[model samples]
Every structure is written in structure tokens, then in C-alpha cells.
Target: MPGLLQNKVAIVTGGGSGIGRATCHRFLQEGARVVVADRNPAGAEETRELMEGNDDNSAVSVVDVSRSNQVQQMVNDTVSRFGRLDILVNGAAILIRTPPLAEVEDVDWDLTMDTNLKGLFYCCKYAIPAMLANGSGSIVNIASMSGVRGVAYGVPYAVSKAGVIHLSKVASAQYASQGIRVNCIAPGGVDTPQMRGSTASAGTFEERNLEHPMGRVGQPEEIANLITWLSSDQASYVSGSTYVIDGGAWAIAT
Candidate 1:
């Protein structure tokens, strides 16, 4: 049998590494043509190389999702090359560990929101029309557990993720009738470079694992499983929902 996303065309932002990179691979395994997009040219190219076959079915786009023009162009180019757009995974984000909210610098706050929140907006803004033209589309925006709960580390990052959750809801309401589905996922302590950097040390990263109910953090591929499922026809009835992929960490959190 063909894969779930066979023949579908997708754009995965932040496809350079972490959850985004894993998602790109998963989408391809499911037989979707993927555009690996990221601001880091080297990282995006590397992801494309690592993908199986890496033939005409896959391409890379160096994009800063924060820029509307670049995002628009990325969508236009994808449509021009692939003839249509069917799925989008907005996985670009930044996490800057900061002092408590009051001690947070103005620049840090601005940068977080611009990339985390506004960047998602631009991707959705441009990708939606492309999907609409095809009569259906699925979008999975990667938010964080930090958004749904309190995190002492980065206030701006948390706030921006919360915005992502709400934006998914608003966009779903606006477009569900038009065959576009929008959803958000808030992942708990996943084992990614961003997580390790935020933990600030290997010891701290391990401690985070012990703190989790599963005694281990989620792997990038683990997160990608849920993402691809949501992007598939299996999730046709699902929209405007925030699926939390935390491994019982939130359940036991005090």
C-alpha cells in the first residue's frame, strides 16, 4: 500500500535540526515530497543529504520564518516546483534561557516573540492560500509545554507558544470549513539540542530525565510520530486541538 502522505507536498520550517529535522524525515518516509526550510543554509542542506534517496522528491529552502517576504517566496517557490501545497509543519523556534521575568532584557523578549510567534504567523499566512488552492491542507504548529504551564526560565518563549496555541484555534475556526486544518502540539522535555542548551549542562539534562515520570525525555523521532499522524488523513476530523506530547511529566509535575 502507498504511504499516508503519498504524493503530498509539504514544507517543514526549522527543518535544520531537532523536531523539525525529524519531522522532515518522517514526512518523506510517509511518501510526501518535502521542502526542508531553515535560516541555516548548512543545516537545511545537511538534512536534505541525510534523507533517504534525496532525489527530486526533496529540496531545501534557506528561510528566516520571521520575514514575511522570504516565507511568501518559499511558498510560491514550493508551489511553482511541486504544483501544489498540501501540508505545513511550523517547527521553527528559539529558546533563550533568561533571568526571571523582571530581569529579562528587552532585546531577549523581542527576539523570542519575533521568531517564535510572528514567524509562525508568517508561515501560516503564506502557506494557507497555497493549501486552499489545493482544497485541503494540514498544519501542525510546534508549541511547547512551557506555554501551557509556568516555566521559570524564559517568559517570552512561553508567552509566544501560548500565542501559537491560540493562533491555531483562531485559524482553525476560520478555515476548517474551507478544508484547512490547524492544530498545535505542546511537547514536554524532548531530547533536542535546544533542550540540552536550555538545561545548560549534560548533568542538568540527565537530571531532567530523572525528573520525568518516564525517567527519560522524548526523542525527536518520537515527537515526529505524532506530527505525521496529525498531518495525515487519519486526523481528518481533528482540528483546533492542542495535543500535549509530554511523557507524563506534566501529569506528575508539582
Candidate 2:
């Protein structure tokens, strides 16, 4: 049988490691030609090697989505090489625990918002046009559980994601009639390099794992599967929705 996304073209930003990288791999498995767009050159190439192998099934675009020009260029390059854009996964984000919100500097605030929120905006801004050319498309923004709940865990990261949730909602509503689906995923604790690094020590990760009712954190591939489904025709009727894959933490909290 052919893959779900056979003949589709996709761009996964922040596609170096963690959820981004896993999503790239998943997209390729579903027969979608992927562009692993990342700010880190080494990480991007690593994912490219993992997915591209010896074929042109996948490519890499070293991009800092925080920059509009770079984001524009990434989109242009994707179209130039792939001929069309079908799926866009905005998975680029940064997490910073501050010395309390009072001491959070303007630079840190800007960095978090730029990468997490504005970066998604730039991708959506450009990718929508390409998707429109195809007459339909799907855009998935990787948000966080903090965005859904009024929590104080990493103020900048949480706030930025909250913006992303609303961003997806607004954009989805605006373009639903145009055959584009805009959705957001608010993931809880996933076992990604970023999640491991977010804590002070390895022990924290283990403890955090047990905190979830599932008794363990999530895997990047788990989230990746959901994202790829959303991008495919399987989810053609889904739009303006926020899917939470937190392994039951959010379930107990509410």
C-alpha cells in the first residue's frame, strides 16, 4: 500500500532534534518529501542523513525562523526544490526558567517569543500562499500545556505558546473556507533533548516522568505520528483545534 502522505511536500521547522526531528522522520515514512529546517546546521544535517539516506527524498534548510528573511528564504528554497508546499510543522521553540518574571530581561523575552511565537507566524505567513497554490494544506503548531492552563512555568515559553494557540485558532478560522487546516498541539512532558535540558539534572526528568499519571513522559515519535496524521487527508475535516498529548497530566489537573 502507498504511504498516507505519498507525493506530499513538507517543511518541519526546528527539525534538528526532539519532536521536530521525529516529525521529519515520520513524514518521510509516510512518503512525504521533507525539508528539515533548523537553526542548528549540525542537527539539521544529522536529521537529513537519517531520513535522506542516499536519495533526494528529503533535504535540509538551515534557518533561524526568528528572522523573517531567513524564514522567507526557507520557504522559497522549499518551493524551488520541491515544487510545492503541503505541510508545515512549526516545532521550533526555546524554554528558559528565569530568576522570576521580574528579573526576566527584555532580550530573553524577545528571544523566547521570537522563536516560539513569531517564528510560527512567519512560517504560516509564507507557507499559506504555497499551500493555496495547491488549493489545500495543513499547518500544525507545536504548543505546550502551559499555554492552555494559566501556569507560571517558564513565563516566556508559556506566554509565547499561548500566543501560538490563539494564532492557530485565528488563522484556522480565517482560512478554513480556503481549504487550509490550522491546528495546534499542546504537548506536556515529552522525552526530548530539550525537555531533558530544561531541568536542572537528570533526576529531575525521572521525577517529572513519574509526575505524569502515565508513569512516564511521552516520546517524540508519539507526537510526530499525530502531527503527520493531521497533515494528511485523514484529518481533512479537522481545523482550528488544539490537541493535547500530555500523557494524562492535564487530565488530572483539570
Candidate 3:
């Protein structure tokens, strides 16, 4: 049997660590040519090295998705190298400092919005046109459970993720007829390095886990698995949908 994404071309932003890195690995395991884009040059290089043994179907690019020109070049470089564009996973994001809406500084708000929301906008702005030209594509935007529910001390983060969800929906609606599928994955407490660091500052990691129904945080690979499936043709009929990989966190109202 062939891999799920055999011969597909994929771009995974933030592909240096956590969910982004995991998704990159999953995409490659499924036989897709991957472009691992991240703001951390070293992270991208590490991902590239980790994937070096894989057959000639993967590369990495240092990119700050928040920059429009950089994002445009990232897409252009992918197309130039692979000759086609198919899947785009917007996984690059920053966690806002936990502060009350009134206490959040302008710089913090701007950074959060720029990276979480505007970055997606810039990437889609470039990737969609390529997808349109190809006549078929899948875009998976990584959202957060906070996007759906209000989180204490996470105002900016929640708002930005909410924007991502809505942006993906509107884009999906507008492009469905043109063969481009846009969807989002809203994950709850995932045990990534970033989440661990955030939790360390906010509270105990175990306390965070208790908020979830499963009493455990999700793994990066779990999220990556869903992303891989969503990016595949197997999910052909699924578009404009938000798949929550939160282990039932959103299903409950505490």
C-alpha cells in the first residue's frame, strides 16, 4: 500500500519543535516532500538533519511567518524546489504573556496578533494562489482550545486563535468550489516544550492536566497524526471544519 500523502508537497511552519516538528515527521513518513519553515534557523536545521536520512523529499527554510515578504518567498521557494504546492500547515505561533486584558501591553498584543493571526493571513495569501493554480490543496491551521472557550489570563492568545478559526472557515467557504480545502485543528493542553514552559510559569503541569477530561495532556504526535490525515486526500470531503484534538476538554463546561 502507498503512503497517505505519497508524492504530495507540504509546508509546515514552526516545523522546528513540538507539534510543528511532529507534523513534519508525519508528513515525511507518509511520503510527502516537506518544507520545514521556522523562525529559528537552528531549529529548522535540526529538523533538516533529523530528516536527512529520508529519501530526497525534504528540506527546511528559515522563515518568520509574520513577515509577508518572507512568507511569500517561503512559498515561492517551495514551489521552485518541488515544482508544485499541495498542503500548507500554519503551525507557527507565540504564547502571549499571561496577563489581564487591561494589563497586556501594546507590544505583547501586537506580537501575538502578528504571529498568530496575521502570520496565517500572510501565509494563506501566498499559498492559496498557488493552490488555486494547482486546482487542489489542503490548508490546516493549528488553533487552540482557548479559541473556543475563554481562558483566564490568556486573553490575547485566545483572541488570536479565534481569529485563526474564523479566518480558516471563511477561506474554506470561499475556496471550496475551487478545490482548495481549509480547515483548523483546535488542540487543548498538549505536552510540548512550549506548553511545558508556559505551564511552569503559570502553574503546576499536573494542574493543567486536571482541567482536561482525560486527566493528561495530549502528545505532539497525536495532533500531528490528525494533521497528516487532514492533509491527505482521505479527507477530501472534509473542509471548513474545525477538528478539536483536546481529549474532550471543549466538550465539558467547568
Candidate 4:
């Protein structure tokens, strides 16, 4: 049987490590040509190396999603190289500081919003037109459980993710007739370098794990699987929705 995304062209932002990297792998395995875009040149190169054996099916672009010019160029480059754009995964984000709301600085909030929310806007602003020309495409944004709940100290992260969720919904509705599907995946406590590097004062790994009813943290691959499905034709009927892959964490109250 042919792969789910055979012949498709995909661009995954922050596609160098953690969930982004895993999603890039999954997209490629499904037979889609992928562009791994990241701010970190080294991480992007690492992802490129990881997909080297796949030949010309993949490429990498160093991009800071927060910059509109860079985002526009990245989209243009993908289309120029691949000839078309079918899928876009906005997975680039940052969690610089997790101070309580009272202590949160303006700079921290601005950085988080610019990267996590505005970045998606920048990508979609440029990418949607390409998808419109193609007459069909899918866009998946990586949201967070914090967006759905009251994350104690992660105010900026939560706010940015919430904006993503709303943006996905609006974009999905606006372009549904144009054959573009937009959705978001809100994951909880996935085992990512960013998560691991969070303030230790927040809690221990075990404590964090127990926060979920599943009694464990999620893996990046698990989230990647959901993204692949969402991007595939199999999810043609799905749009403007947020899938929570939080292991029932949000379903239960602590």
C-alpha cells in the first residue's frame, strides 16, 4: 500500500528536536518530502543528517519563526525546492522563564508570544496562499495542555498556546471552503528537552509524571503520531478542532 502522505510536501517548524524532530521523521516515513526548519542551525543539520539515508526526499532551513521575513522565505524556499506545499506544522516555540504571574517580566512574555503565537501567524500568513493555489492542504499547530488549564507558573506559555488554538480554529473555519484543514494538538508534559530544562523548583520528574492520570509523561513519538494522522487524508473530515494528547491529565483534577 502507498504511504498515507505519499507525494505530499511538508514544512515542520522547530523540526530539529523533540516533538518537531519526531514529527519530521513520521512525515517522511509516510512518504512526504519534508523541510525541517529551525532557529538552531546545528539542530536543523542534525535532523538533516538523521534523514540523510532517505536521499533527496528531505531538506533543512535555519529559520527564526518569530521573524516574518525569515518565515516567508522559508515557505518560498520549500515551494521553490519541492514545487508545492501540502502540509505545515507550526511547532516552533520557547519557554525561557516560568516565573509566577507576579514575577513574570515583560520581556519574557513578549518573547513567548512572539515565538509561540505570532510565529504561527507569520507562517500561516505566507503559507495559506500557497495552499490556496494548490487547492488542498493541512496545517497543524502544536499547542499545550497549559492552554486548556491553569498552569501555575507558565503564564506566557499558556497564553501563547491558547492563541494558537484560537488561531487554528479561525483559520480552519475561514479556509474550509478553500480545501485547507487547520487543527492543533495540545500535549501535556511530553518528554522534551525544553520540558526537562524547566525550572527544577517547579517539581521533580516523578511528580510531574503523576500529575497525569496515566502515571507517566508522554513521549514525543506519541504526539508525532497524532500530527501525522491529522495531516493525512484519513483526517479529511477533521478540522478546527484541538486534540488533547495529555494522557487524561486534563480530564482529571489534582
lDDT of 4 by residue, 1-31 (tens): 7889999999999898999999999888889
lDDT of 3 by residue, 39-90 (tens): 9999987887787455579888899999999999999999999999999999
Candidate 4: segments with Cα more than 4 A from true spot: 199-203
Ranking the candidates on TM-score from highest down gives 1, 2, 3, 4
> What 10-residue stretch in candidate 4 is worst by lDDT?
197-206
Q: How close is candidate 2 to the true structure, as a TM-score?
A: 0.97
Which residue pairs show backbone clashes in model 1? none
* Top candidate (lDDT): 1
lDDT by residue for model 1 over 8-47, one digit each (tens)? 9999999999999999999999999999999999999999
Question: How do the predictions measure up, each by TM-score?
Answer: 0.99, 0.97, 0.96, 0.96
Positional deviation of 131 in candidate 3, in angstroms?
Answer: 1.0
Worst 10 residues of 2 by lDDT: 48-57
Candidate No. with top TM-score: 1
Better candidate by TM-score, 1 or 4: 1
**Deviation in angstroms for 250 in model 3?**
1.9
